[model samples]
Target: MKPLLALALLAALAAPADAQERSGIYQQGEFIDVWNHRGGHVLQMVQTREQLAATGRVVRIRGYCRSACTILTTLPNACLAPKARIGFHAPRIQGTQIIAPYVDQIMGSFYRGGVRERWFGGWNRSREMQVISAREYTRLDPQARFCPSLS
Candidate 1:
């Protein structure tokens, strides 16, 4: 009986955490900050681009997502919540105000073609934060699943 109990404990320990509980707004630069502070283990997890790609779970953007958070747009299953808002701006080096073109390019590339054109097409010349309204977001990706609240 002790052996069986030990096996059960091991099984429970090995079980993956609930993905939904882990789901939340991945705010801008949060990933970068975690990576920098924790190196590889962002709380016992390796925060890698590949890891981000492998996340088949849905990402619900319910609030402002900026900078590094924009990368979440590329997740296999990404959705915008009813009141979700996204902020776009030129990338800046962590902890500094200097703009970084390479980073900006990477972020821009993650967006869908039409989204890129509409958001970056005009009126954002100064690299200031440009907000994309929930209405426009639904327009751009009509097929995208909306958060339950909106439905």
Candidate 2:
């Protein structure tokens, strides 16, 4: 019985990371908060990609978005607050700091064509926290709409 339980545990561990539950609320074409997101597994980003694309929801980047959170920029209705900051870097395995080329390719494919070019041109993978200011981001992605302030 103990051996069977161990096998179950191992199987659970071996399951695809996307099968793991993530924390976020989905409300169709309403608001999405991709703010202050440091990012985790690439699979999580991929799993959410369809929802983001399908809903045409407004993704609000009101704070710092690092790593996979940058994927939000790919959404058709993504928007940034005036003070929002988006961070980018090569995809790396969590905890180990080991770079994953396949994950990086997945991330690279998410970026808009021009944004991809600009990002690749200026990116420094070694730095691991290159930030794009709201102003600069707007310059690079002219189609990225801005959210209106409630005040």
The candidate maximizing lDDT is 2
- Write model 1 residue lDDT over 2-117, tens digit each, in one string: 43234334544553364233223232221211111111212222234344444443445555555456555545555666665666666555566676545545555656656667
- Model 2 residue runs over 4 Å out of place are 1-29, 122-124, 149-151
Report the alpha-carbon TM-score of model 1 versus the true structure. Answer: 0.57
Quality of model 2 by C-alpha lDDT: 0.64
TM-score per prediction, in order, is 0.57, 0.71
| lDDT tens readout by residue for model 2, 1-151 | 3432343345545544452232232232256545466767878877665666665557666667677777777677777878777888777767776776677667777786566875567552544578888777878777776777411
Q: Which pairs of residues clash in candidate 2, taking residues 3 or more apart in a chain or in different chains? A: none
